[model samples]
Target: MNWPAEAAAGCSCAAAVAASFGAPAFRLLSAGLALLLAVAVIPVCAVAVRAENWRANVYNEGLPSHLVAVDKNRQTFLFFEKKSPLKLKYSFPCVTGQLAGDKQELNDLRTPEGIYFVEYKIASGLDFREYGGIAYTLNYPNPVDRLRGKTGHGIWIHSKGFGLVPTRGCVAIGLKEIDMVGPRLTPGTAVVLAERLDESKVPQPDNGTARELRRLMHAWSNAWAARSRKMFDYYDPDSYSKATESFAAFRQNKERLFKSLAFIKIYNREIHALEGPGYWVTWAEQFYTASNLSTEGVRRLYWQRGQDKKFRIVGMEWTPRDVGMRADFQKGRLVAAALPPPATDASAEAPLPPRLDMPEAPGETAASGIPAVPAAVAQAEKLLAVSNPLVPRRAPAPPPAEINWGGRPGMETDREETPPAAKMPSAPETPPVLPEPAPPATPQAPEAPEESMAPEALSLTPETRAALEQAVQGWNTAFAARSLADMAALYDRERYNRLPGVPRGQSYNSVQRDLERRFRAPWLTLISRAPSLELQGTLAVSRCEQLVVAPDGAEQGVRTLWWQREADGNFRIVGSQFKPEELGLAAHYLEDVSNAVSADLEAWRKAWEGGRLDDYMSFYAPDAVQQGRWGAKNIRRQKESLWARTRPTLVQLSGLRLLMDKRGIRADMNQVYADSTGHSDRGTKTLMLRFDGRNWRIQREDWVAQTPQPVGGSPAAPHQNTQRAMP
Candidate 1:
């Protein structure tokens, strides 16, 4: 790929967008990968504000924090919060020495460092190959990393991934950290990691690193502060100044954003180095409108020094640092921070499995020649259109990191197809009682130093065997449901396992607490289909497809997952993946657009509600694609799509699962879309939605019509609507 040209195109697109609003020139500098290059075209004219939707928030408050790293050399690192007089120690299960690295490739593991915080948290299968729970990636390798001549790769964290052992070079940690920090860490949290952890390396809150990050905040704030398009340093040269057409658009938008807030300010900030040279600093944008309406989730950020040497922010993420800020400006306080999309590791020539836990590469196809999809698979490809979010997906996080499950049968970790979000049919005549199966005859966690597991004893009596079998099945089903009650009922309550991917001091129980809290609410919905269950004695795997939705109509699909029957006879999700749709381009676009909208989810929502369709459409490429039952086409297809959804159908939407990226949004709707006659479908539809540089629209779909067919359709009477029957 032409990196320079792509970079230039991004710079121009961003500059042009900023110019469109008659705002100062904002240019996209060298940072991130082609994925980052793909979103320069998102329009900033019509801001859509969706306040009801929730964002995962991460922050820092002079707390004790440290970064740990493990490399191919079997070397590990723990960088503590040096500024704090208190130096605390953290211990974690280790999994180092994956790749057979040469001296020249010391930095190939691609660990990163920057002022970043955890965007979101989820039990990502990619994080743990052996025992997996949660995983979080550091917002690393900021633009500065590239400019500083640091070019390993990013997404440095510790987890037992979904595949076999191999990392260019990175550190591994427990699942506990991912859950504890991923969601709480927001944009602007400092994430810095180096080979050394001495006091000298401590970033004194006012160090140059801090200044660069604050400069970013100042730039964005100033950008918002100004209405004239000049008085800025960034932006493409040719389109440096706004032409007449662009000037008009900029003035309209600039006026509203600048004048609307009754009160606004930076709420909170944090700093950290997630890995090597990758630092991040997050700032919360808090506001209270004069009308008594208020917002606390928006987070503005600057990712300085990615792979780039200068401090150019790759993008801003959504966060909730100011959540506590009250709606009443008269008496306000902070709540929680907003959450941003999960981040993805910038990949290069290094070989990686589809999931982090899987040991073997599916097949070593050259990364340069990654294959494209064929026409028959267009439906599947559309599902793939969702971007790879920065946080653990709404449900399934990243794939489990590769682990050595000790070449055992019945013990193999399953691939992540989707989260078990769909409701299963009530027991259908209770299937025949099957005999107990063996536990794949092998352990599935190789990288886990073996201490987590105790000595095993085989049990073999017909009655005892049957009892164990039934118990395992029951537990499996509960996990499949992902129900708060069912999950809580099965919690060990004691002797919990630290799985992998979380921060050092956090507890796994906190993850359970968060999941329970989230599941208790109706804001997020899972969008998975029926699960196909398997048994390998005490070990079991469930492969399923699902849709996860947010309060608004946003959705994401989940794929494969594996779970084990705990000693308490309850089931817990052990490993999982975020790519249940397997649709090409979905992961790519999800990350790009989610990153875009997350920075301003509420703004985008308001624009949509106000019917700023043209301005709304600017968030995507002019050449954007689309696919759905209404059929597929270019930008024009929206006409048909809008007519179909808004037409007199009775789809009752409870919560929408949204997966996003820099380009736009992907949503899984748990729609009870009623028939014009009023029957509800209670299932889900997978929509590959996106912004085409103007408005949020569908670029593709793998939507199963799960909408139920009403009773008594005429054999051949004049058709009312010809949509497929609900599954």
Candidate 2:
């Protein structure tokens, strides 16, 4: 009401009443009404004031002011304000993976539960239908995820224009909601992903596990700075081996750096920790400087609490971005140089890097340990004033016709095309960049313990095999004849250096000198039979039974020679391993046997390409299986029938990788097949070969069909093989 106007109107009405009736009677009635009005207004005004205070207090005391939290179980995405006086700025309905559980391997449709950070925002060049014109990628497989041997890449918080459809290990929300929250998710912003989140259950400031993790991180960092071997002690060697590179390889690399650099400086900044389902993630912005290399990046260390109630680092993830470390180092060096020398003879030790001082929990009161309100439910009375609708329940459908040329089938392709001259990212590079995961596989039967490939069935062609035999004989003759030129011509110094297991302090020059000394011995003689040769790509391995005669005595042994093809297209001896027969046992030359199996694989490919049906059939064992047809006879019958109709014109194999396990030698390679009918297809070919006394025969063959596309194409985006467990 307008108080002045109402008062004037009331006075006019009172005057009129007084004039019409008796003055005393009108005055009494007016006073009585005014008293009644005052009595009603007093409590209303008081209630209004109290309600405002309550709203303000609720905001200040309740909620976490700054954080992004995702609850997979509830399908809620919450964003809080960065400023103090706790408030939940945005709450939106979201959808996670259709399946539940933590992601483990590639293509596993389950969101990983962990703490991560927004690495970057993808605003364009994405499928509008799939990504809702914007997406933010989270750094999954973060250092901790990698340490756990978790595989996959490309987990993102995105929006889909069609609907909030459940994702394949991604978090999705509405378009409007994402647009509002996207700006706040800057690079390095903390993101906590959990199966379920409850603000009321937030841990207190002094979380024991988090503190222990921080201590462990400091100890490891200190050891690294000191260049001490104790650094390895912090790592779970067995887990580290499976997660990233082999423990030996990692140690060797670190040791080499430790010996090479005179000093190392590491400063960690903005350290924070977040507890996940079963692990804790501790991350910091790290600045590293060595003799020649300087880099700065965000490093996340994943720790698992053990049975002994101790935390140990299991894996680590690094996000490299320039943080001006080089400039900082130069500036610091200049300042230090300007200072005068110490007066004492002995220089003072440098101060250690600052220890982690975690911030206390926000809004703790004396009377109550918890905040004024649980962040997730601050305004329970008006919770859905602005809320996203639930995602429609529907199965994923393929997008409409689009020119997704290079991307995997049914997925979006990049809008921007690169020039022909630009280099394309290959399959090997996907593991580090593309977020993906794997699935459980059936266990395979173990093979014989002493399974080794025979020399005769090596991958070498007949001509190459014959040449290798002659080369071995010539090497022996050259040694006996004291022909230095002949012996030198057969050796490849560079290739020899690559040969593993070479004795320490021995070099190509030393071996040559030793050979020269033996050449001068008048009674020195070398006799050797034809050598078994295996060729994989340009590298070959040859094993020979040899007898050496000297003035003092005679000796017999097996000589294993490593050969490499030189620029001149000749196979030259790169390295040699010798074991004496006096031990009454054969040399355990497993490496040699593996190489021979690879050679046989190449021969098998050659036979297929040449349409040598009999030879190709012979490569398979008597009980071999191909494409579900059991027994070699059945497999051969199918192949013969197919070949009669359309002969293979080209059968090319590349990227051959062989793994020798207890079951047999598993050979995986990319194969391209073309036939007389002009049909051409490509796929990954996996052949399981078992050594059968004299040859490595294929026991089982499997082919996974793939639509061959130019690398870096959209089609190849989601098609990536699992990264090798060992580096």
Candidate 3:
């Protein structure tokens, strides 16, 4: 309105107001408007606030954020990792490893525990190519875990929506958990897991009445060792009087423990103090046995320091080995005598209990009803078979017969491939012992077909590109701020497709709701850094490590990317790979701060190629399921039922790659494994891999047999194979 004042330089403040009024047309301009427009158009935070019943911030407060359940058995494998600031209830379903065939053990099937991170994220699994709409991968066995010598690797916490069901060892939650819990997980989300749910705590209806003291002991013992779910009715909610009443639960747990028929005698009972009915209960389990051999020793139980801490059983120092059990039969006799006679025969009756079976001699197989093999060495046995290759496979080999090929299917062929020059040939040179052909004459690798490969984009010298590195950091910051559509606009439309903003119905309300769901996962931290970007002329590859922190205040890392370029660029990201572990320079970088790849390459290849897949896969979780290049990228998923499925006759394991720190060891390895599957159609495959702490597994398995390309020019990116819960 005041033209003179607005135009004059003398009235500077008035000119500022005029400039604000003249700002861009589409959107209003002001300090507050900028902040509101930044995160996303959808009001995600508000909706989330309304939905969340509880509030906790794991990062800032450093407490248990939330409980995580990997319910596998009856959908009950509740492995809890607390995420602080959890405002709403989060639940989802998942697929599990294959159920082991025959009589397998607990260590077989791999439902992982400890800590992990969401290392990579996708709008879809490469298995479905662009058809699938969103998934995330977790860094399961990290580098910090070397000391304990754990095995198995390449696990994911992805979407069930990625497909219906089935996964090697990945947890497939509902899309809600994907949107809600995954994104907030920075690379450091602590994942504390139990092998399965603790059966001892589950309450059941009262089966019968208890009268005498001995009956109570048996019931308690059954509850303690077996982790019986039937005893849940006994846990008193009133017992938990405070914010934490774990101590009360511990007391009830003890009573149920002592009630099992297997329970011996309670030599001592000491409760220093009591908060309500619960106090720290420290006790012992009293027996150890061998086939015909018998011995007894004490296994002490350690109580939590206070009533609030989780209950743990551990033996204390100075507690005599004899205290756990008597060295002779006298102690057992005495314990039996001390138990007052049960009130009735029904009270003393014991159910048929489960026990460990001993191995019998080979010829004794018929007597035990189980087959056995001889222990002595036989002349035909091949030794020193394929272990693992610490280096590449292309390295020159020694003579054929000189190397041990193990029980691999094509062992004879592999041995035949060895250089003849190193071998003592039976016949004289018929044609000629010719000198090696010149290097140039040998065909190397196939050239990249133009149809499959993307062209280079963003013409810039390394010097100018350096500036973009800094700019990328800022761009990521904006991306983190919920600029979903804005970030997509920066991508070259020619090469990529952006996920549509969240819809209002079954999906979500807007991009903010979608991003907000992703934001809940701790692994989606600080998305503003410039990941490694490679521009191959017209084809650009931008890669970055996903830094995640666990609920335990520990950090885990993942690898991911965005592939695109300018509007005019013809090259595009038609294909993508879901590689979660930080391999190569990325792994080295983990050690730079602090940890860990696949199972097959490390387990089978290292063992078979070198000979240890049999013993190696033995360590694989019985329901050990593996998905890789065994067949097709997306089609080849293998679930090992037992030693039967893997059929490892004999193999060697070597070149253990382990990571060490003050806490313990995080193991990574390269091994060669070969075995006889009793079939001519079979051949051993090589694998390179890492350890996730539970079993020796195959991580990255690029087969000796090249994965076949689809009829079309390019190879279709594979989707992750999934396994369903058996019970």
Best by lDDT: 2
Clashes of each: 223, 28, 145
RMSD (Å) of each candidate, 1 decimal: 29.3, 29.5, 30.6
Q: All candidates' lDDT scores?
A: 0.34, 0.52, 0.30
Model 1: worst 10 consecutive residues (lDDT sum): 399-408
Ordering by lDDT: 2, 1, 3
Q: What is the lDDT of residue 13 in candidate 2?
A: 29
> Which tens-of-lDDT digit does each residue in 469-489 have in candidate 1?
454445445543556676655
lDDT of 1: 0.34
Stretches of candidate 2 above 4 Å error?
Answer: 1-66, 81-87, 104-108, 143-152, 201-203, 306-308, 324-329, 333-727
**Candidate 2 lDDT (Cα, whole model)?**
0.52
Candidate 2, residue 309: the lDDT equals 55
What candidate 3 gets wrong by more than 4 Å, as runs, is 1-67, 76-88, 100-109, 123-125, 129-133, 143-145, 161-163, 197-727
